[model samples]
Target: MDVQILFVDDALFMRRVIRTALNECGFENLLEAADGDEAIRIYRESRPGIVLLDITMPGKSGLDVLDEIMKIDPEAVVIMCSAIGQEKTIEQAVRKGASDYITKPFKSTNLAGIIKKYL
Candidate 1:
């Protein structure tokens, strides 16, 4: 399959917003997971090229999902996205092997556009 990006967020609105931004950037191979468990399942089945993960959620926060994803594939490209003032959580995510972190309210251009080059 072609390279793809998975947007993992508890908020459906945030997922749609992120998807729209990616689409505007000319990316069409996108996927979504409203919660961590579904994220893991999809990751296993599809093995998307990248993951845009939100930190806060109802259960199994993005951090936890990142850990699980890393366990499944150590080379997984996971970018943690969190609201401002959550430096500690972001730091922890980085320490756990997240490829990058972005603060919320970010433009799609802020999402490591060059990342597509690597994929």
Candidate 2:
């Protein structure tokens, strides 16, 4: 409940859906970013407890942001969320220190479960 979550996605609708899902789960301290740059800026300033990051965006892919965030704080919790479910991509994310990976079009309960796992 107290833990802050950052939702990084390029789509406004996706962000809204994620927010609504988490809100229903009683996660009120949520931050959002429409792109990688803004996500990085917000992450640096706020240092949220958990980050739900998307892989695709206009600039600076989610993997790039993940690398930067890891450099900033090795212990930071970052979960990758994207429609791309390629095995190689997931492996790369995990290798880069992602806490977990969630494929898009996921159920709200599943997302909540993942978030709760890390918290």
Candidate 3:
């Protein structure tokens, strides 16, 4: 499919991993943002079909970005990424309008499955 997928994370490695995973699944239209600010900017311009966001970051946190993105596009399909034991933040992200949540150290295949279901 030609659906646009966006990855938002502060970690370069994590973003790279996500890219490779999506690539393996035959997804070629991928975008990336390293912080909440960049994520929001890219979201507006790219209007990606799905957004995979990291919960913690140096700048605007993912939760804030999620809220802002929802305001911009209520139907924005955002999936919050969290490390293990961050259930509280993940729950809050959901409440803030995240479409889904994925635990870190994820399998690319698993992420592709989620994207397929939503896309």
Candidate 4:
């Protein structure tokens, strides 16, 4: 099956940009959510092969979603995305269960390389 990925970001533009990059990089099954709560719901229902989550959001935070997912499945492969200078929060996310973290405004090749390593 095509590698499935669920991308969660509060910014619609960021989501679209990520979706486009993943699509162009051979990931055909991409799902997106605008917030962590929706991300949790989608993740529970779809159980995608991978997840790309943004750290800062309006509600329930990506870290919160990561916590929930880890509770449900310790083996879940999650990648945290954050802007520069959010080291503490990102580190907390890593401790919570994220397999990797990426910064915002990342190059498509960087994303593709990380995804390749994990998925």
Candidate 5:
């Protein structure tokens, strides 16, 4: 509901930062998950319209979650977020049904642009 978005990251700071960026871009319905397992649980329950996943998390990792999400819904809209140097992981996520991959340290404009494309 309300253009739902779920954001998964082990770091609370990163979650807040991305949530804030999305809010600045006029997005309001945001959910937060601290790890991949929790992200998967929430995804099944809430069925958010969009998901933003961080690749390097505590357990299961983003790619693992992406696979799980794809299993649940082949058409799931997922955007993988990777750090500056994780090209392989990003590529793998894309191959596994992620809608796109966004390199970390991104500007609000860039993130917003990606979301707009999905919208």
Candidate 6:
């Protein structure tokens, strides 16, 4: 696909897993950020079509990044990724303008499906 996607997570392993999954699904235009600051910087510079953001990170948390992205572009498609039992945080993220969310330990097919939904 031509659409660019931003994947933000503090864990290198998690980023790699997501990248591998998306790559298998034929999504080659992907970007990665280890923390929220970089994610925002890239979002500002690149304006990607979608963002797969981890809810908890070392700095500036995913929710904070989501807020800023929403401010930058209300129509931006941001899908939050969080660990299990973060329903409240997930709800808060949605309220802050996240397009959708996926829990951690997600299946590759499900992740690809969600991205395709926005596309």
Identify the runs in model 5 with alpha carbons over 4 angstroms from their true place. Answer: none
Report model 1's TM-score to 2 decimal places.
0.93
- Please report, in order, the local distance difference test score of every candidate based on alpha carbons: 0.88, 0.93, 0.92, 0.91, 0.91, 0.96
TM-score head-to-head 1 vs 4, winner? 4
Order of models, best lDDT first:
6, 2, 3, 5, 4, 1
Native-referenced Cα lDDT, model 1 = 0.88
**What overall lDDT, based on C-alpha atoms, would model 3 receive against the true structure?**
0.92
TM-score of 6: 0.98
Model 5 earns a TM-score of 0.96
RMSD (Å) per prediction: 1.7, 0.9, 0.7, 1.0, 1.1, 0.5
> Which tens-of-lDDT digit does each residue in 20-46 have in candidate 6?
999999999999999999999999999
Superposed by TM-score, candidate 5 places the C-alpha of residue 57 at a distance from the truth, in angstroms, of 0.7
User: Which candidate comes out best when scored by lDDT?
Assistant: 6
Q: For each candidate, how many residue pairs have backbone atoms clashing (under 3 Å)? A: 0, 0, 0, 0, 0, 0
User: Which consecutive 10 residues in model 3 have the weakest lDDT in total?
Assistant: 110-119
- Which stretches of candidate 4 lie above 4 Å from their native place? none
Worst 10 residues of 1 by lDDT: 110-119
Candidate 3, residues 19-83: lDDT per residue as tens digits?
99999999999999999999999998989999999999987999889988999999999999999
